[model samples]
Target: MKQFREEWDLDSIYVVDSALYSSDNFQQLRQLRWITLVTASLKVVNILVESLGEETFEDIEVPGYRIASCCSDYGGVRQRWLVVESESGRAQ
Candidate 1:
């Protein structure tokens, strides 16, 4: 991400697989000020569903990331989605 920013002078967004989902990776992305759309794991989805009950989606705020959106599967396989943007991008 740093290379991308330095070389191209551009902000970036990454669509990553579930394998890359981790607290450390998230922190790194936040530090880089990059946005990411990550595939939520089943455990994560289950927890959200249990906490949210009937709600399928919500916008949330975190310390360094703006959780622009979150949604759960209402049909088909159980799945969850999250669109996380760096706090620096919030104004834009």
Candidate 2:
């Protein structure tokens, strides 16, 4: 959740302890919990953000303008990159 931490100033994501859920719908519920948590955190932090397929960004970040997507994906706080995706540019 580095993006949230750095850009949005959010702390770690909530622990969804899927194992604790013994219901048949545990998987679905766990996934939903993640979505709800991230969405709520964004709103609560007052970041001008949007949730597309994945990866939240500043409201002004475009689709292909070379984004430094330090998407600290939390489950919500796991980040997959120390840098961003770019062929010849820096992380946005």
Candidate 3:
């Protein structure tokens, strides 16, 4: 986790998101409905792979991408999106 914090900056390590309460288009959003959640790369993709048995996936779907950008200024793990290398057979 220390490695991630240093590499992703304090914002990515500590994220927050704002939600406007009571908008005409998003009436579902309300001050009373506000909540907070926690998300970390190690807690997400890493954990998912772990649940699937990392030993079995070593030859399968390895992490072919890296965290190109993470905007903790947005919300949750919105910053930890997958990135495809230019030479890789995938979309950017």
Candidate 4:
């Protein structure tokens, strides 16, 4: 990210896999200005399911896909956890 900013003078948002997830890593990332889009691991999802219940999710329709999201916090930062649930992933 430092190199990207230095070389291209651009701020970046990362779209990463669940492999990058960890409590410490999330905290570190929260300290930076970079945005992240990542899927929550099943363990994390299960915790929310158990605590909040499935009905807490609200549907959001993006251009091509549907997302179910809820108010949540990650690494002390308030954010939403989203899940895709569209078959064709198209707004039809």
> lDDT winner among the candidates?
4
In the range 2-91, model 1's lDDT, one tens digit per residue, is 574466554555555556555645544443433333444546555763464224334455566544245544333233355455547545
Q: Which of 1 and 4 is the better model by TM-score?
A: 4
lDDT for residue 70 in candidate 4, whole number 0-100: 69
Models ranked on TM-score: 4, 1, 2, 3
| Per-candidate RMSD, Å | 12.7, 14.5, 15.1, 5.6
In model 2, the Cα lDDT at residue 44 comes to 23
lDDT of 2: 0.35
TM-score of each: 0.38, 0.18, 0.16, 0.49
CA lDDT of each prediction against the hidden true structure: 0.48, 0.35, 0.31, 0.55
Tell me how far the alpha carbon of residue 9 in candidate 2 is from the true structure, in angstroms, after superposition. Answer: 37
Point out where model 3 deviates above 4 Å. Answer: 1-42, 58-92
Off by over 4 Å in 4: 1-9, 33-41, 49-65, 86-92
Residue-wise lDDT of candidate 3 within 29-72, one digit each (tens)?
22122333323333444454334432332221445632232223
Worst 10 residues of 3 by lDDT: 21-30
Stretches of candidate 2 exceeding 4 Å from the true structure: 1-64, 81-92
Which parts of model 1 are misplaced by more than 4 Å? Answer: 1-9, 32-42, 55-92
Candidate 2 lDDT by residue in tens digits, 16-68: 44343333434333323232222323342233223232353332355544332
* Clashes by residue pair, model 1: none
**Residue 79 of model 3, lDDT score:** 29
